[model samples]
Target: MIIIHSLRFLIGLALLLVLTLPLQAQEARVTTARVEERVIVETIALNGSVTAPRTAQLSSDVEGRITELPMSLGDRVQAGDRLLSIDAEDVALQVRSADADVGEARAALENARRRLREGNRLGEGRNIASSELSQRETDVAIAEAALERRRAARDRLEVRLERHHLRAPFGGRLTHHDVAIGEWATPGTPLLTLIDLEHLTLEFAVPLDLHHRLDQAELEVRLPAGIDDWLPARPIADVPLEDGASRQFLLRAMLDDPPTMLPGMAVQGRLLLRNGSGPAVPRDALIRRPDGSISVWLAREEDGEWRATERRVTPGASHAGRVAIQQGIEADDRVVLRGNERLEEGQRLILDDE
Candidate 1:
């Protein structure tokens, strides 16, 4: 009877212990995500600026007084549109004079040819001397030569007249207008500055050591307006020349489909250098410790029960809010994304999805 009473007291103490324990001590709710295997690439952030493919200083090829200064700063123009016109009256008169000379030369040539034709006909009937016919033919040749010279002179004057008008070589906007109407324009002196807006390039000064990796890396650019999307860019030019002072080289890249951005606008870019592939998880799942170690909590299923396990991980390059796990994890592993901070080893896991 004493042994039975002792057994009943022990059973009561066991029941009391179970009721006194907190419900949280048994299981905790957690949010988890499956690990994904993907390619991991290292990225180098860069600060750069936008630049147009063509920026030209428009100027006249001939010396003259500016007669028409039609374009102002910020005027968009098409190719071959005249921006400035020089006083072309003198050239126009010269062209007219050359035209008259060509006409006289042509009339003289026609008369000479008629005489040569008459001499040839008389020579064929043995009525003209061979020396005389030859002389007539020589006259025709000399007149033809004179006509060609006059026509060449006329064409040259017309070209000079065209040069009096300064036209845009490409479609662009005028960034600067330095010359004014009635200003004495000289050859090679810039009158305006034009920047091509159709094609743009992103310019970056990258470290010399990483220059070689630019070809293997993918490039992207973003504007300074706090936009989230990155524009895809490709390397257009890598100047092999390096700056001695900065130890950097120029890298010019172009976007596949670029937004409207002004030249010289500040931009940001990144060079993504792919190294290898590995399992990755959301960044939230990572727990950084003060001791410079990184860890993650994982949910494991065994015997129809879920439990939590803390595992130390070696993190690699992170991209798109996910970090590649170089070690201590596998693809399809259930990583605790939320409530991982308060987790303890061997604790029961009640998944939020459940």
Candidate 2:
């Protein structure tokens, strides 16, 4: 009878212990997205600036005092238009002197030629000595050389006179004008800044890794403040030289139909490379770890329960809030989009249906 009582007491204690034990903890709620296969064209973004295709700083080619400056800042000018004029009085005087010298030389040449011709005729008649005829020929040759020298000097003087007036090298708008009437102008002194807006280019420095791909890619430019849409551009130049410090190569593109764009405006450039099909996931699913590596939380079934699995991935270009997974993750995989920050390796998860 004692044994039976003891057995009943033990059974009661077992029941109490079973009731006191804690039940399995509820699964944490999470939002998940299925990885999808998509066609993604990789793109590279580069910062650039708008620049004129042609720009020049007009400088004085002759030393003189400024006499005429018809164009001012913001003035539109055509090629060969007079931008600034310096006093050409001294150069003009030199030109006149040179002209006088050339005329004198020509007269001397003509006289020498006439004498030589007469001497030749006299020699033919045996009335002039051979030595005298030779001397006359020598005089004619000397006169011809002197005439050439004088004419060359006169041409140089005329060119100098023209240089006293600075002309526009191309059609452009003047942005700077530093010369004034009566201002002393010296050779190589900058007087005006001209920029051609009709042919504008977008310039950028891209990493050397993209040097080969630049030609094959389609480029677009986005002006931050002026234009609302991306402007299509074609690669104009890609300099092979690279910056030593940045390891970047210079690239320039011509805009197809730029609108109201100006030089020096900041712009963003996009280079779209070849189209590729790949698995893509929501951008929010990506997590950047402290070590600067990117990863995503994957919900995997284990022991008949959904558990979070950390996956290391290589991320490519992003579009429409979705990022292309270059590696590590595949299509049809459940990727946790929300409530993943607190996820742990193999931790149980409850999917949110809403």
Candidate 3:
């Protein structure tokens, strides 16, 4: 009878222990606040080069030895400013020859008129045929045509001679120099490279896959590292064709205020995705698989265990490393952070400080 009583007491104690162990397990794990909110996701993070709106390679129009170089690289100039002067000795000689020809032609034309008039006045008796008078008139016409031709040639030479002194076509700064004070400049030689940097450009490339996002965009440019504020711009131009290698379309924009922006400086911007609502998550939450697959582990209550389950997520833009969750888990979902290594489908996880 004593043995039977002992067996009964042991069985009761085992039942009590088994009933309390689950509560202990529940106390061991941690819980996080489940908060949900609407998020507007945007796609805009892209890289591009800082550039100018207009660039020109000024060329020499006249062939001559450069006698003066008044402009240097980075020198600001205005329209019609004497950029450089070439020795015009040869051009001047041509001009003089042309002028002399014009004078001789004019004299010949005058003399022919006088001869025709004298013939008509003195030979009125008989020797001067009507045909001879008509011939004289034709000779005068020929002289007049030759004079006009000489005058035209003179004007052309004068225009060429004016080009010997290179002048600025527009207001710009000299960004290069190819001629010295005594260097020979061939016609069409690049003499200077000019750029207008005041109103500058930020030509950026957008991947063709993302072209839809930017195709109708009003751009917003920002350089978080260089500038404190976002710079908005109106769209300017684009390359209709996508780059075969990079599959990106190039674009340009004019800044609202660009007198302060410097050209060729490092800059980055995001094309505004007029659609202003999308979800986002910390970039660190993304788990890149060995095969280059991407996934995330979500902590959830399942089968009475606070465990992590892998979920494949489609990620989008990343701004300052904060990734936009275009398609994946909803907001306020607890994801494994530090304990991702121990994470598995239905594997128990406890946030250290949850």
Return the top candidate by lDDT: 1
lDDT of 3 by residue, 50-102 (tens): 78767788878877788988778889888889988888888789999999999
Score residue 205 of candidate 3 by CA lDDT.
78
Instruction: Report the lDDT tens digits of candidate 2 across residue range 1-354.
Output: 999999999999999878765322335689998899997868789899988878898899888889999888999899999988899998899999999999999999999999999998998899999999999999999999999999999999999899988999999899988778999998887888999988988899888888877656888888876466777888889876644778888899887767777899998988887667899999899999999999999999888889989999999878657889999999999999998888778788888943
Q: List candidate 1 stretches off by more than 4 Å.
A: 1-21, 224-227, 290-292
Candidate 2: worst-modelled 10 consecutive residues by lDDT: 19-28
Q: Candidate 1 on 1-354: residue-level lDDT in tens? A: 999999999999999888868665768899999999899988888999998879999889999899997888899999999999999999999999999999999999999999999998999899999999999999999999999999999999999999999999999999999888888999988889999998988999888899777668988888876677988888888876544888888889988777778998999998888988889999999999899999999999988888999999999988888888999999999999998878889898999976
Clashes of each: 0, 0, 4
* TM-score per candidate: 0.88, 0.64, 0.60
List ranges where model 3 is wrong by over 4 Å. Answer: 1-41, 61-63, 111-129, 187-189, 223-227, 240-243, 275-354
Instruction: Give the clashing pairs for model 2.
Output: none
